[model samples]
Target: MHDFDWIYECAVIFYVVSLLGYFIDFLQNNRKANRFAFWLLSIVWVLQIIYFFVTLMQINRFPILTPYEGLYFVSWLIVTLSLLINWFSRIDFFVFFANIIGFIMMSVYVFSPETELLPFITETMTTELFFMHIAMAFLAYAAFTLAFVFSLMYFIQYEILKNKINFRRLGRFGSLPELEKMSLFFTMIGVPLLLISLIWGAIWGHLTLDTFFYFDAKVVTSIIVLMMYSFLLYMKIMKQEHGKKLALINIAAYLFLLINIFLSQSFSTFHWW
Candidate 1:
């Protein structure tokens, strides 16, 4: 059990590092950073393989029969697919998103056992899940914040080019397309995380609230944020939009999200104290 924990912790560390590398590569088009991240993911893959066989030997059967085991296996599959994509193509964005899923799966698997091991822990698991919901929300916000920065950069770069001002240093940051796409990738990462966070938050509220109000400020603003970002994604995918339009939308969505975050702290009559 201790060994399993150690391996998972180490793998998670490497997974985070690899994700950071991929993120940097996606934003900068840095092939060297991409190569480093790829190798790190490979290491994580190898670690998971080792952990799988070790646990299999310990249990004397395949580990896929249980929910936690299923999570572990699914995480492994995601990593495998991500590595394959990185090896074969230019879809580092997919790898970034895929590994977010992988990291989440592994995180769930790691924390779940503690909840089962102790009686009090088991009882509090639902509450812990609620906390996870909040945590994921913040993570989504953080991803969106990055998107906002890149989008703002794109906006600035566009203005520079539009004015016909050749700022040589601007090129060091990234090209306009690269900045826009980086913003897109960051938003892509945030959207699902925010969705999942909202789902979990809704479930908790439904269970706990005596009377639910759709018009609550937190709820309304959160939904608005989600809808706005979702629309941004739709335009990118379906409308094939580009340039200042999408960047502006992203910036707008993030600004609203920030407003929601600070304002959501207020206690309405319906909310818990």
Candidate 2:
């Protein structure tokens, strides 16, 4: 097995550095802070990837059998994708909340000590199709999470403008249109991936649940989360909502997803996490 202790310890340190850099960027309004944060976050992701392969080799299976492992991997992927998007778009504002959430996720994994061995059922289901399904699902969730961060920033700045408050922090950001566009872009990509994930999940569930093809808690919660996004998408397409309202909807949807995901993981009888 890889040295879980060492890798996890390094991951925690890297997250802390990235978190600090992002926080500095938010407060000091320094573009370089974002650059530093992204680099650190990227390094940590690379290390985590190495650690994951080592873990799989040691256990002879994928490292997603536990909620901790699965969530950690998703968090890393979110950071990686955010970095890529920021590089191409040159929009650095979202790094603050992204790193903050990523740091919290890393903390959770660091604190929750667990083995990485796959359960028998997990091993049986780890086919190539299953891998694709889980990767898409997690990436979709990550995109939504990033969009939620942008939305929150948009709302905060929106409120400042509404109140006619002249805050220096708000001055650091680009125009509201700019931030809203980025948030909308992330949500658009995330919604389609979520739809695909739901369909693949249904197929996998049918394959696994031989007896009944009804609703489990995880499935029900996932569907509800999906519907929330669909509602936003519908509104956006109809041109009925824009700007702050759209951002608010994305924030609300992600919050609901977070609650549902955690609750099902905690109490469901058949949660894969």
Candidate 3:
């Protein structure tokens, strides 16, 4: 367990260095710098994989039940998946969003005055299926985090266009079409995973000691968010909406999701570190 903690600490250091490289790359539009950032990010991802396995060795079971482990794993999944996407597509558009999300979460873990792990979160509330369910939930949310950032950039670019602002820095990034498509792609992937998580959560809730309809405030808010995203999906699929409008909707959906996660954590007695 102590070794796992050391691994996690190393991961935080890698994340900080990667974040700095990403910032420099973004600011200077330096391809070589971005490549270095990606390499560091890749190393972090590999180390995280080792940490995950080490955790399994220590706990002798999956580490998905506790919010601390769950959030950490989900963030790792997001970065790993993003790296894979960039590798296959040869597109760096997701890199910025990925770095920002990764850095924010890593920072929270590193600097938050409390970083203790909760044994009871797993010992008390966890089930095999429930663990899998939350893993899916957070993984989807992490991807949505990346998409949200991209959508934000799109909207900012749109605003600049609308206002005839002269921001040459924005011009250096991917075009509106490219960013919108990427954002839409990620949102499209996240929605169904979130839906599955919702269903699994209900099943797990019923199996737990809690009442079937306890429906914590976070759960209700999450359902609402799911509906909101579903509506956006309907608009995009049936109504053929795309581009800036779709991007804006994506941004709205992520905001709702973010709020739901924060509020959900509030309701949870378990540590959400």
Candidate 4:
């Protein structure tokens, strides 16, 4: 195998080890295990960076055209977000779930069937607008995913609070207030990113396809997803909507977004992948 491939495999192994460390920390609340998890994940991130750069050099373009590459990018985004949350808040609970997502993404990428690399710049995908659109869209997706996780955490904590259940046995999960803040933070960030992505996508389509807009399934679904989040944010910030209602809205929006993404290719003419 090539050196980059070896590095990739090693990164995967390190991620697994890091995940185990986090799991142990969750189970036993061990500070050492938490530290180990952070350090191991840092190593994995470094290795992944090296592997990504090597692959970029080989491909001579962004390695995001294939499913495997997309998975890798998503996994990296989740890991990066997890690390940031840990650094800022010393909250490792999010890291546990984020790494679970990262592991699944990496596993899918490793096992998925390989496809031959296309030429460095295919006509349809070569534009700066296209690249911007894809990047912003995926970043928005990652943010929304984090928001979804936080919302789920909020609901769990809310339930515990309502029942007056002891939280001491629940590991390192955040308090309801913390979870609420984080969820709102992610949603606030995600909405603008998604809006920007849509704008770029429209520009790309107009420049390449001679159409400024189309009422395609992907387009319509994306708009719906955007509007739902916008409403959620509006109600939360402007009307002071809180608690179960906000959490449920966030959860429902994220679920709709996921479904839209999964079914988009089947019905949308513009997005095939």
Most accurate candidate by lDDT: 4
**TM-score for model 3?**
0.86
* TM-scores of the candidates in the order shown: 0.54, 0.89, 0.86, 0.92
Rank the candidate models, highest TM-score first.
4, 2, 3, 1
126-207: candidate 2 lDDT, tens digit per residue: 8776676777778888888888887888898899999999777675555788788877788888888988987887777667
Model 4 alpha-carbon miss at residue 263, Å: 2.5
| Per-candidate alpha-carbon RMSD to the true structure | 8.8, 2.3, 2.9, 2.1
Clashes by residue pair, model 2: none
Whichever of 1 and 3 has more TM-score, that candidate is: 3
After superposition, candidate 1 runs with Cα above 4 Å error: 1-126, 270-273
Per-model lDDT? 0.74, 0.77, 0.73, 0.84
- Please write out the lDDT profile of model 1 over residues 1-273, one tens digit for every residue: 555768778888999899899889767778798789889999999999998898778655555433466567757876775577456644345566557757886887888753122444233333655666655665676577667767877887799989999665455456788778878988999999999988988887787666777788788888999999999999999999999999999989978986775556373444321
True-structure RMSD for candidate 1: 8.8
Encode model 4's per-residue lDDT on 1-273: one tens digit a residue: 455699989999999999999888888788899999999999988888888889889867787765567778878888888888898885568888777877887898888877764454365786788888888888888898898888887788788878999767454687777888999999999999999999998888887874544788889999999999999999998999988899999999988997776677588775645
- Clash count for candidate 1 is 0
Q: Candidates 1 and 4: which is better by TM-score?
A: 4
Question: Of the pair 1 and 3, which is ahead by lDDT?
Answer: 1
